[model samples]
Target: MSAATTAAGAATADEELRWLADGRRIEAIEAISVSAMARRLPALVVRAFRLGWRIDRGAVGLLLTCQAVSAVLGAAGLFATTGTISALFGPGRVEDKLAHAAPSILVIAAAAGARSLLGITIRTVTIHLSPRISRAAEAEVLRATVAAELTAYDHAGYNDELEAADRGAEVCVDIVGEAQNLLASLASLLGAAGVLTVLHPALLPLLVIAALPQGIASVHAARVQFLANRATIGDRRIMANLRWYIHVKRNADQVRSDTMGEFLLAKYDQVGRRLDASSRRAAMQSARVSVIGAAASGLGGAVVWAAMLWLVSTGRMSLPRGGAAVFALTAVGTSLRGIVGYGADLFRTGMYLDDWSSFLDTAGGHRLERGTETPGAPRRIAVENLGYAYPASDRKVLDGVNLHVERGEILALVGENGSGKTTLAKLLAGLYLPDAGTVRWDGRDTRDLDPHALWRQVAVAPQDYARWPLTCRENITLGQPTAEGDAAVLRAADASGAADVVARLRRGLSTLLAVEWMGGEELSGGQWQRLAIARAFHREAGLLVLDEPTAALDPRAEHRIFQNLRAVARERAVVLVTHRLTNVAVADRIVVLEDGKVLQEGTFAELVAEEGGRFRELWDLQNERTGVPARRTRQDQRTVPDQRTRKDQRTLPVREDEGSGR
Candidate 1:
């Protein structure tokens, strides 16, 4: 086949698979009779029962018991009904007929009353079990999804499956009830079948034949409903996301600022139109199927009545027997129709449950391995030829990078935006595994150590740190809950210059941090950054990685943090990743990275001493912007050009200090 044709065929195949997942397509009703559904009914019924049984075995058993009692009562009532009718038609005195029917009248009354009581009991049991099923299913889904590998969230397939599984959890409550009702219907059906056979064996086949068309219709309607559900799910998610964007407190400011209301509504309407159109089409198709089934059912009923009348006239069946047979046939037909309807519901629910099953299976494959080994506090961390690329991406974020940091030393990483500074720091922090090389902590590979154990020894504050909506004390203590009170918290705050921010709060540490909530207060960008820094400091881990830690801090606050750097490093290693070159002056070592590769590594003074190196050139450019001349000796000053000549030389803004790959 041509490529275009092949692609179309593949698309068609996927559509077919989705249809088959829920059984046959709606359009196949004419090609496949009700007999085809018989083969799959047993499996769907069993699965539905298994699900209900797992949620609440007691409820399942109670429901089945009620169904059994109802079925037995219904059968007795049918026979009593026949006995009463036969006595009414028998020859004798009026008194005699009344006496004979009176006993059956009481029997019928008892059976009817018991059936009603069982039905009520069934409803009560369902009420008790529905919420339990929903809660259990939701918990299971959340447990798997929350623990799934972080990389799984990056893929669209995982997101779609998650949405479907969430919907399935909600439907679980109804599925259990439907399955129970199906069981009850089957019981009623079997009871009616036995009655019809006892009255006259010839009538049993007619009951099955009468139910075929309605069964076909039920299957067809179910398939149409499933198709509509699957088709609109993605669009519904988009609409939901748009609604959240429009209505949530967090996005309200931006929505109003950018006047995004109209744009978002437009997108919502666009998806809404497609969803409405699909729903209308599905409804029309389902209605047509129902009409066809109803017409066929009417014809079958007519044929049955005609056959009964013919038999009575021919004397092949007695009047009372024929009457009872007609009643039994009607009951059997009703029960069979109910069975088919309930089966359709189970089939539809099974498709949604399939989504849940598939999500769990896929998540299992991607689950992060929990290592068994644990290591002591690292004396040194080494990155040996480390490389990393994000999932489904071709370009590497860190390429063949090598570095090391020792205890009680400060290592500063300086790089421009998108230069792999954060990615490298994350590798060193054991948050990600290298694609091609190893990160070793005191000669033990990070992959060999339990991730949870390794994470306990490290702390990180990224540029976009979380601002938890909690009390200030809770936020700070969140980093180290075991720390004893305000003293330790205030100490970390003082180190990061966050103490001043806390000192100004209305209630100090007791103040709620979320202004959006009632009786809560907000923090400015700089204050939040200080709090984040305080959190990291409170961790007191063996190693700390702070990415753009001073991004929101003022120059004075940044200077204070740098000045306190020596004291913070006295007990553990520190790695600072920032674009601000001035922050590196306090570091014992500095590494410059460009385009995923190490450009230079040394102390600040050593790098600045090189006349034409990349680090020295960057330093000179920054100094020129700040009106600080590069340091020079008396002999070098004598060689400098005169002021007027220098002014002319500056016209083109040429940097004579620009290095040529030295």
Candidate 2:
């Protein structure tokens, strides 16, 4: 009793903590909290450096080379200036000759050309590598998401994952910038030191004292800025979502009818105000950091300039050389500033880099593997006592669930909300694993079978299907288990409803999608659902599990499509999940489910004929609700098997039955 009480207390505490962390606004505020910003700087910088080396290899090499050239160019520009001063003083005989203007022109031209070429080359290299790096990062993330178990996706908000993906897409740009700046800064700093060494080796110590403090302070400042940005992400996304709702056509009428414009604007203002506060804090922190940096620069420049003034007064740095020393001092200041700027950028990019790195490092989800062998058609599938719960759930969603599917028959699964109908369908489709039960194909554990092989024979149109913003031809081919060749896409599109869609599309199969960016127009919800079905049809798999396949379809369309599906199911086994009982009569057998357990199973005629059974209650309720006659005389209500005499186990949903079914 004591142990149980302790466990309950712990659970209560955990729930409270989770509730505290859950709100979009509250979570965003906490995420970007800057209290420990300084602590993460070193890690962030390190992560940015690693991404440069890993994803943008060519850009990174070019960055290093650019740094070297920039240093050389700085030295040359210094040399050219020195040559000018020498020409005035006749200190070097070469400078006296160059006083004729020809040599001076060549020196100026060389310095200008080197600087221009370095900038152009670095930009070109970074741009050239950006696409490849972006593609690789996106691919890695997609692969990870697909391979991971389904639970992760269910809990993560759509906006959160999308933002993460956007960050992944920008990883290349951040990587290139992080690397180029670091190299450029280092080069500039070294050139500054070299020029200062020539000016007066004694003053170098003061320069170091001034520059190093700012570099360290800049790193700390960057951390605070990143934290502030994080704190605003949640609230920012909410405002963005609100804006989307207001602007979208479907929601426009609803918004106006409900007078939601002011509500949305208020929500936006609330988030925006918090964001403004966070931004103000960040700006203040930045101002403080800047003031410190400026003070250090002023003190260092003053010491160097004062020393130069002293030398000039003492005839050490002559009038012309003293001017040169001042130029070098200015260059040193800019170089020190560059070093701090680069260090700060590198530090900030580190956080983005770590996310990108972790995302890319992930592999093995929903990826094509060599181990998958070609699977042939299965005669039967049996699920024996299959049970599962999600990763973070304490309650078992599917407890002692058992099911079976035979070749060439339709099975209808009926259940209340959250009764594990969809979960069972996913398990049967091999998209999920059974925690304690065995899923066998012809009595062999499916674990031994290759997943790719299994997928080739199965097609599942999920409860929530992806409406890819792609061409009509591409959409249907996605239904296929494998990537189809161009010719196959053409053929698949022809069979599905996509051919009609293609005709309407100005560019047909090549048309791009999205009003935000390209040539394609948005599809209607009903149209999108049809397109999704077409994708499944194109795949031509033997096993099909459809959850609310006609949920978005009009009644006439839904009725026709199911008729078409029954005709198409001639050579396949279909598992259908739906809330409506109208089509339940079409299945070979009906399985009644409630609270995640199968309450009873039988043909519609067999189950409905029984007194007060769950199926009878549901059936009676549906017919009564629709005012449909209980007795049926038409042949349209039943399915007859083909001439081949297997068992009368012929699966067609029956509205009224004489009790002759499997």
> Which residue pairs in candidate 2 have backbone atoms (N, alpha carbon, C) closer than 3 angstroms, thus clashing?
32-231, 44-350, 147-365, 147-366, 585-653, 585-654, 586-652, 586-653, 587-653, 588-651
lDDT of 1 by residue, 356-453 (tens): 77666665345567566886768899999999888768898889999999989999998777889888888888878788899999998888888778
Show model 1 residue runs off by greater than 4 Å.
Answer: 1-55, 477-480, 483-494, 497-519, 556-571, 610-662
lDDT of each: 0.82, 0.68
Residue pairs with colliding backbones in model 1 are none
Give model 2's TM-score versus the native structure: 0.75
Candidate 2 local Cα displacement, residue 129, angstroms: 4.6
- For residue 638, give model 1's deviation from the true position in Å: 44
Q: What's the TM-score of every candidate structure? A: 0.81, 0.75
Clashes per candidate, residues 3 or more apart or on different chains = 0, 10
* lDDT score, candidate 2, position 198: 80
